[model samples]
Target chain A: MWRKLLTRNEFYVALVVVGLCLVIGAVNPVFFTVGNLFDLVRNSVVMGIFSLGVLIVIISGGIDISFAAVAAFAMFVTAKILVPFHFQGTILVPFALSALIGTLLGLINAVLISQFRLPTMIVTLGTMSAFRGFMLAFIGAMEITNLPPAMIAFSRSFLVTIKQGRFTYGLHVSILILIVLAVLVWFILNKTMLGRGIYALGGDRSAAERAGFNIRRIQLFIYCFVGFLAGIGGIVHSALVRTARPFDLVGTEMSVIAAVVLGGARITGGKGSVVGTMLGVVLVVIMNTSLILLGVSSFWQRAVLGLLIIIGTGIPAYQATRRRRAA
Target chain B: MKQIAWRAILPKDTNVRWLLVITVLVFVSMSLLRPTMFFTLDNFSSMAFQFPEFGLLAMAIMLTLLSGGIDLSIVGVANLSGILAALVLTRLLPAEASALQVVLYSLLALATSLVTGLTCGLINGLLIAVVGITPILATLGTMELFTGIAIVITKGAAVFGFPELITFMGNGSLWIFPVPFLIFVVAAAVFAIILNKTAFGAKLQLLGTNPVAARFSGLNNTKLLLQTYMLSGFLAALSGIVVLARTNSAKADYGSSYTLQAVLIAVLGGVNPAGGFGRVGGLVLAILTLQFLSSGFSMLRFSNFFKEFIWGAVLLVVMVINYLTNTRRERREALLQAKECEVNAQAD
Candidate 1:
């Protein structure tokens, strides 16, 4: 029964998450409190969105270290356009602009990789630096702190609430957005022909081409999708914090990739799920919060996250080895 | 007539020729942009010194790429080893040690760093080769693992105050060239030999060309994989020692930028990501070109942002060119084979 349970990917991920949460809750009851849980979910939402974008690329058998740079670029562009035009009152304007910029950047990545037949890793690596340079040049290390109060309130508003005398819990707007995206992505990945084609291409490019799939178009779409997700994530992150700092997301891509890979996505592609990614995001957020609540050394937290990434990927890797041996 | 056609169209080993052309073009452009400074020995010497640290990293990246793998943990290994060397030399060494003693200590530091790299490489190799994790994912995990350990050990602090001999290795000049530059030449020569002359080198090339075929032919895939990673780790560690010696300080994040930069160097050098076709001579030229470009930007007083922009733009352009050239060659070969097949069929 145990072996059978371990074979199901989602089952194993769910079990591990629940087990960790329970252990943490047991150690510190505060970890289970309504207020704490809500805060945890809210904090995880923006990062979750970014991870979702990375998941698209990973699923397509590519990797993008440029996501964080693109996110920072979007945030800078949003701030520059909104602040200069005095359109900060209209949250939709900056949000849409950021998303547009992100999509455009993604399209550039797609064109270079697909059209030029360049390696995805090298192309994105170059863009990461390029985008970061653009951001630094545009912003000049400026911080946009004077966001409209309405925008702040909208960002901070609770979308769902439950009250108990002297205690309350609620889901933030960010969490709502994350749930909506998760659902949409799940639908697209599982129910669409394009999604299946993506899997086919990632599985084996030559075979997919032989089967009459347009490899170039699918790759372009994948990169653009990741860019769009990153844009949305950047806007949401800036809104939640009520300020735009151009350097806010440095080193964030590492964490996002770790979460996605840990959740059971194969880096070589053709294997991943939105549901699995969601759980992976939750696991990482919980680990961070639990470490803080337990008063573990801040230094050790990074170490723990690193260890989790290794072990998480190692599990499936080990399983694959065993299966190959048995065969 | 055939020889002329081959010279114009094929240019036997065009990759090497192209690399040389690019290097010369970059140098000429730099000289034009900064006429007085670009050709000066002082400027060249400084540039030479600054480049070997990155050169070492490029070498590490080249080895792993040749073996049909990638090592994301190189920068992290470099950071860990360099920081450890800094800490020991500053905190543990006696102040009155002779020059020879200091040199001995530096060598010891390098050996320790190589060992650290070996261990990390072993873990990465075992995961990818034996455990069946893909190269990128396995190294990505180890990248985090090794870097995290570095952070934990140092708590995000920088270490400094190495012995003068160690510092001299990084900063001192021997005649007209920097000590580090000399070390780089020696290391590169040794590596070039190991990669081109040895049986192990041939096996690595075979592994990169076709792992399954190599395995079917009775090659010990696992052992070769392990050795390749070990070599990468050793070089990374050596880079760390050089880095520590040069800067006179060791920070936990010393080599963070190298992770992607090394990949860029390798790819720009014509090392195919799919593996099995590259040469050290091309890689060496590519590294010099990149270093000159960056150094020229600084000499021209370009802003940090502009320098970064130029680096990215150059990297992208070079990569696109390399990709197009390879694809064209592949198509030409395929067409030739098709014509050969058609001729045979008609005869039959």
Candidate 2:
């Protein structure tokens, strides 16, 4: 059992996350505090929600770089509409509206990819720019500062908050949404026929089609799901920062993709897991926390992140090769 | 029959004809709309000067795409190259410069930029070829790594205020012809010749066409891939140097928007995203169209955001058209093969 667990990519990734936490905690005891952990959880929830979408899309044997854009656009437009009311409706209104708009935008990409049979990476590249451009141009290019009251209120009212003289940290409502969504996506990806179809379609498209899979439908569904998550992720992001700015998430595709890929999700598709991605999100979030703690130059942060991603993927690859050689 | 023969003799990009028509129309309309302004030598010169920075990047992207790879690191490579050149100038050379010192500084900076670009390209080439990582992922990692190095070197500050000679290369006009434009033209010319005239170019296309078959045909697929990425890297570095000159500064994120725009222009120029096909002439025309649009939009007081929207929409539309044409061609070939087989069966 131990040997099997050792062979699993998720096990190693989880081990790394734990190992990194221990190291950081040792270096800076403040990092081990409950408040610090809560902050990491909050941030990781936002990234984790989006990472879930990326995980599914990648496992379906395609890539979507436009999720951040889709998320930002959806969040901005939804916030634009609702910000006028100052977040009056109980949180569901904003979430529902953003998801709808995100789905519509994602549908455009899906239709193009499915109908014309275009490459997803290039298509998403264009759409990412287009969506961001659309938001910057037609949509409110400015940050949605006058956010909804309920949204802000909900974010403040965490499931649990331990306050210690201005040092307050606990799980927020978005954390609840993140957990529910992750579980839901996990169930759908693992237990449903659609999930297996997505896997088969990605593993081998033509073969899947020959064996009675609706390749086009699956592709569209995959992107639509991604768009929906982007919507949720965006709203969660805005509620956390309490503003919707296109620039906030404009170039974040790298970090989100890094987290997902590090979770053992293959870019070429047909491999990934929710638990793995969840751990991956924590690992990335912890790394960010640790960097900020170390007061490392913000510029070196990106370099370090890049190095980590390369090494993260490389070590597993090397191990797989070594194991094959041994056998 | 003559019409079909004409089609056969010409290149596959019929889209170029429509692009040409639109470009000429846009140019003529701009000229009519802003008669004195658009037709002026000054406007033409500035446009010529500005387009090459991303123009070289587009060609770099084209080279990688020809080898069935995509490079997200061009902008990063450019930043690193420019930053290193700036460091070499500001650190090594005396700040108060005579004419001879200016010349010496410029030469040294130019050489520094070239070497840095080549080294970065070699790393990318090695990562994709020897390390066997996907082009997109490999370049993405290096993009971060390179940009990080630039930031470390500059400490996220802008490096600028070079000697007069180097400034002249970026800004000064030689006989009313911009030096940067001249440099770009020469670079574009060399890229055209290398891609269309060289055996290596053919090898790149064959590899993109079918790696296994190319391998069976006894070509060093790996070497060709490496060379393609290296050329791409070199061009990206050249772009960096030009950008450094034009802005009179080198920041780690100088051309953040450039990487996307380069991909847009390459595809707009009809380079196949899946690889195995592209032309420098077509790419140049695409750059011209985009540059004219952007410069024209600015002159008209339109927002820059609209420019990105147009590029994205155009990319999607172009892909749709390309996809349709490719499917139609494949279907025609399949039908022809079917008929030929039927006739052979009768003969048998």
Task: Find the candidate with the highest lDDT and give its number.
Answer: 2
Model 1 spans > 4 angstroms off: A1-6, A138-140, A148-150, A160-170, B1-12, B95-104, B330-348
Q: Candidate 2's residue-wise lDDT over A1-327, tens digit each?
A: 999998788998999988988877787788988888887888788899899999998998899999999999998899888766555668889989999998999999899989888989889988998888777878767776778887788668788878889777677767888889999999989999889988887788888899898899998898998999999899889888988787778788888888998888987888899999998888888777678676676768768877877677766655564575579
What is residue A244's positional error in candidate 2, in angstroms? 2.2
Q: How many residue pairs clash in each candidate?
A: 0, 3
Q: What share of the true interface contacts does candidate 2 keep?
A: 0.54
Residue B60 CA error for candidate 2 (Å)?
A: 1.0
* Top-DockQ structure, candidate number: 2
Each candidate's fnat: 0.55, 0.54
Report residue B306 deviation for candidate 1 (angstroms): 1.9
Reference-based lDDT, each prediction: 0.83, 0.85
Model 1: CAPRI class: medium
Report the C-alpha lDDT of model 2 over B254-285, residue by residue, as the tens digit: 88889888988888788887889888877988
lDDT at residue A39 of model 2 (Cα atoms): 79
| Candidate 1 structure quality by residue, lDDT tens digits, A69-153 | 8887887787776776556466677777888889999998999999998878889988988888767864566778876555587
